[model samples]
Target: MPGKPIVSSNNAICLVGGAPIADDAISAVFTFVNSFVGVDGGADHLLAAGVTPAAVIGDLDSLSDAARATFAQQLNHIPEQSTTDFEKALTRVSAPVVLGVGFTGGRLDHALSVLNVLARYAERAVLLVDAHEVSFLATLGHVAFTAAPGTRISLMPLGQATVTFSGVRWPFAQTRMAPDGFTSPSNEASGGVVTIETDGPVLVTLPRAHLALAMKAAVRAK
Candidate 1:
């Protein structure tokens, strides 16, 4: 008898819509969730990544005729006039978290739109993972991390953030990033856990490679 086929599971979904996705971006996605979103052009990114999208949610404007044809039969085809396709996809997926690449980095307007979605989906635990950084619409909690001794971590404030950290090159205790906050860029890890205390949504980003490794570890643990 033939052996059974191997089946791998993926909860970490990647969205490659249209934001100039990085070459290494696909490595982070255990599963690719296609969103034929308009404005962001995420549908194009989906096909380019060679991933058979588990779900393609979006309006029809962003997708090219050929792209639409490619996914014609598979599309979930949400025609809601109010929600963006990206938002539509996020609503449909039941995953614990999402790593949304190609959702940033193209047009400035599109990038801003992605941010709006993040804020709206803040309660969804969706992390908008992009080439340059990972953004989250945090509500109330602490974000912590432990990486190899010398990894660099950067925090850019979106909304006001009351931040604190240790085990970093530059440690700040109860620091606030206000309307005009410090850059706090290029801080290195100190082989221990770094914590950020915040009451609202703040954009935190680190090296994508480290996050990819961590996500892989998470899958293995599960």
Candidate 2:
């Protein structure tokens, strides 16, 4: 069974999953998110934190009876085993950008799976945010954003790509990158604005403070 579709007026939505999410992080998500979608056990977390999501989407495997009772109307169960709950929600929702909390900072495998989903869904602008960092898949285009000087920026190739980047401590001019080979990590932004141009998909990571800039760039990239 697949989940019911969600119709959202807002272009951006927050996805709360079953990972550790800080209180401040939840507060920050609510500040910008026009709606919330809970993934299975994440609905329990949201309810525990006094948040009622617009919809709860998952395979119905991890959600508790108490959570189900509390938000029965919001449950949209998808009984498929092929995809993770995060991917299921991502495929079902329509948004210009999706802010993901509680999807990272968990078990290493889970975090890696989230990144894989971001890569697979390159057409969707999804930001996987944790306490310290924000990551998104960079598609074919020029992504420019503002960040503080000395802020950490990392670029990991999701697939085969040629990229050119500037406004950072180390600049790459038409550099070839691939998943099996090169990755630029621990790079620092040199000034207020940083830009990266890629012919294929890559993952861009930055400090959490630059969430607004990342979101802006993602929207522009779309």
Candidate 3:
């Protein structure tokens, strides 16, 4: 169902925010780790799903007394104007790897900001999960993926980092990629394994069906 999460994580945590997060998406947390929190509406969602938050962050603007009470012990009130609560969670996360869901797919502005944040903090091990895709900010290391022969892997540059890809339909050895210059998109996999190696920021998009496998690989990195 839409309310039950499909994947879970131990290396990753989830942030519930102002927008609507699917139940299936919520259940996905079971596949990973158990650490979760309510980011305003996200808290309410947690309670609705019968999941208590490990923490509740944000300005406490949209949070209610009930949601607050539900996550009282886990509540870490972050009253900062400099960044979003979602960012605070990502920033404070000490885990070696973090998988994120419910960060996108609700609003365009927030979705775009998620990308911006991913770019700004490419050094962090993070993956953004959406309804249709799973993306990570391609950083200085090697990102490897194995997709169906017809599956498409596309790259879009973010910030100061450059993208040099290999093992894909389009190849780049050591190339600088920025928002203004050459772009990589609609690239197809060559059957075995598809690897994208870069030193900066690039958005790696793949179908939702591949997210489970992709996340597993990302967390397995050295």
Candidate 4:
């Protein structure tokens, strides 16, 4: 189970995971949120970047000796093996939105696990960002945004859902979507406003250029 809050903030917070973080990706995140929460080994990344997280939460298994010693006071260790460090830190932080970095662009299984956590905690406004794209679980079951013509817009269901779309080259309405059944990938936006509505959770992904808009839409979803 997720433990109590370790860091709560009115402004949005950023959770750094154990995956390798690119310099440009780290720079992108700083444009939005300053408050940071390092999950286990992620503390080492933050320390190297010269930013100390307000708190660090995880099982402490992957945390490095340097990070452990540097952020000893900030550590909030949860020794349970049931959850990943990303899930542990994500659930313990309270904010209007969470921008997750260092959670992708790594091992395939680890990247997939991050998506699982996003789907499991769909109620929270979280955006998993990486080098190329930004992904978020549309918990409110709907989202609207504007993108340039031919821009890539992908909607993937972690479970099952009936989804509808507009302002896309291949629009679908109330069509059942799921991991094994059907998925929308490489869909192109037709320019101007794009609207998507779903009856259940759907993961929406767009180019990293639209990160600001994605964050705004996510915060307004619920």
lDDT of 3 by residue, 1-222 (tens): 113232234456666666766657777656666577566556877787888766676778777788877678877666878887677666655565676767786788887787888777766667776566777766467767677777778788886556667767777777877788877778877677777777767788777678776666556344
Q: Which candidate tops lDDT?
A: 4
lDDT (tens digit, per residue) of candidate 4 on 1-222: 345688989888999988987787677888699599998888888888888899999988888999999999999988888888898898899899999999997799999898888877777899999889998887565678888999999998898899998999999898999999999988999999999998777889999989998898788433
C-alpha lDDT score of every prediction, in listed order: 0.60, 0.85, 0.70, 0.87
Residue 163 displacement (Å), model 4: 0.4
User: What's the TM-score of each model vs. the native?
Assistant: 0.77, 0.93, 0.83, 0.95
Clashes of 4: 0
Could you tell me how far off, in angstroms, the CA of residue 96 lies in candidate 3 after the best superposition?
1.9
Instruction: Write the residue-wise lDDT of candidate 2 on 1-222 in tens digits.
Output: 135457464568999999888877777767677888889888888888888899999997889899999999999888988999998998888878899999887788988888888887788888988888888887577888787789899999988899998999998899999999888978998987788899888999988877887887777443
Q: Show the lowest summed lDDT stretch of 10 residues, model 1.
A: 1-10
Which pairs of residues clash in candidate 2, taking residues 3 or more apart in a chain or in different chains?
A: none
Cα displacement (angstroms), candidate 2, residue 144, comes to 1.1
Per-prediction count of colliding residue pairs? 2, 0, 19, 0
- TM-score of candidate 2 relative to the true fold: 0.93
- Comparison by lDDT, 2 against 3, better one: 2
Deviation in Å, model 2, residue 57 alpha carbon: 0.3
Best by TM-score: 4
Residue-level lDDT for 157 in candidate 4: 89
State candidate 4's TM-score.
0.95
Worst 10 residues of 3 by lDDT: 1-10
